[model samples]
Target: SGFLGFVALNSEFPQVNPAGSVLLPLLTGLFGAPVLLISAFSNSSNIPRQERRLAFPSVFAALKGSIAGFFVSIFPGISSGVATVVSSIGERSDRGYIVTMSSANTANAILCFFMLIAAGRTRSGASDALKSLNLVPSFQEIAILSIFSGIVAFLLTIFFGLLIAEKIEKIDGRKLSLSVLVFLTAIVLLLTGLQGLAILLSAIPIGLSTHFLGVRRINCMGCLMVPVMIWYTG
Candidate 1:
């Protein structure tokens, strides 16, 4: 749906203005409707289940995550979403998974700055936006901002972690999922217009297959991966 939305915005095939608003309804219809149905029809499992025993994140986990994140930072078009799936291959524990996810996301952003300095190129939309605004900073400046952002984020996390965590824990899973669907729907509709919605609706089933087949959503990366392979190989 998202890729299709991009196409509708860029291409003149449909003879519509290039706008992201078209993706709104397509996505909302495809994904939102299904989740909404599931949320409404499915009964919550009230029975208590045995908890799976797991260890907290350890030094090895952090190191592994840091390394993986560092590697992902260098790969163009391999977004954090794809990195998460790829990194999950060797990960053993939930804590480890979280560590990888957190590190990948943060490292990707931090590396984008370094990417500007090293490759003299911007690979991310944020970097492009920064370039467009003519606000590109030096490596030293980036380092300082990184430290400041990390400190602030860490402090904020410490301050609000428990309260926010508790509140999130209290939210029903189905309700939360439904809310996400609703939010996506609203965002799609409000931003893309009717055509974007059409594309989104078409893409929903493809996205849902990941869940039904018990596979990682990493395959979604095929959107870029296939074209990339062709671009390089061709």
Candidate 2:
């Protein structure tokens, strides 16, 4: 939903034209409504009952962070590539810029893949720890927790929306801050993408699976993470 809002604001509003700018608020509102509604539904559905308590939080956090990372990586590359192409065309240059950008993107993609692998390894280690402690939640408990957490998150979003509306007359300044935050966040996400964060993210699902499915965390973690590590390192 946040990404949809960003796109609506950025793409729908023509900065150079008055007529388009005038339509910005209306378009934002129009697009934002359905986006939020869809997001609410999707988020609610993503968590199952069995993994709600032990797995849900980790899964939610990992998925959220992973998504944020994806956007961060994607948008920058897109904007950069677009800019490079525009500049090349304007200068009547060859495909040098395009080639360079492609190479860089490919490298980044490979690095990101490896990072996910490393994160998987880290998750395996965490799972081993869980096994030693013998702490695992039941499926029923997981389901209850998942539903409760989702409700809480939904309520929080509503509350925050109200607070934001009460405080700001317009979203312009807020959008600028959001842009900056996204940029900084992109850097963090990229770093996470490179090392062990990806594995960690996957491990989140493993944790949930273990807790809810009555599987050993160590076994689940090993199944998910070990292959990732092997693939990455090999």
Candidate 3:
């Protein structure tokens, strides 16, 4: 780990990529392949669509999310997950949680773009890389990028979600879970190398313990959030 950092300290180190990218392959293999496999094997009955209720007011979620997004945007190292917690003060259903958290993440990113333009700050490594290359975008460029981003997000989340919902009834849950678990394991090993892979394997017991002990997984997020709180306070 330090070898790469050391070589890059005084001079640029040779950049190398892992043999295979993790995300697209993982998603397609973990989700797509399993869905197809399960559908091919399982006999399905046509399920009637159930009426889903909106458990919380969309306006309330949006308003609170906007406020939390603005708050987090002002502070470095705070994440959209924190905003999600802040906005979800009341009891919410699964849909409510999804919409609120997704909205918070999108809102936070949009706010970061504004914050960057206003304060000349690089909130992410991608932004820093672009700055390093003198490719800082103008407001017009950001606007166009944002529009395209919104379209892509809409297509992926809504359109793809609809497709998933349609085929979800045909998929075997246990098979799908096992497929995802194996796919994810391979992905971590490939992308992160042996040490990172070892850490992930080591953490499996802790993760299982939490699930068995019925602990809220939010506590795990303290790993990053706790240090950020200390950083800002100090």
The model with the greatest TM-score is: 1
Q: What tens digits encode model 1's per-residue C-alpha lDDT throughout 1-234?
A: 345434543544341333333323533453456556456557861223333443456666666556666776686646666556666678877777887778777777888878877886665556754665667899899999999999999778766764565465455667667677778766666555555556666767766676678866566555445444555687
C-alpha TM-score for every candidate: 0.69, 0.23, 0.61
Task: Sort the predicted structures by TM-score, highest score first.
Answer: 1, 3, 2
Clashing pairs in 2: 49-143, 52-142, 53-142, 119-196, 119-199, 119-200, 120-199
Candidate topping lDDT: 1
Where in model 2 is the C-alpha error above 4 Å? 1-137, 171-234
The alpha-carbon deviation from the true structure for residue 103 of candidate 3, after best TM-score superposition, in angstroms, is 0.5
| lDDT value for model 3 | 0.56
lDDT of all predictions, in order shown?
0.62, 0.35, 0.56
Residue-level lDDT tens digits of model 3 in 64-86: 77788778777775657678888
Cand. 3 TM to true fold: 0.61
Off by over 4 Å in 3: 1-57, 112-139, 229-234
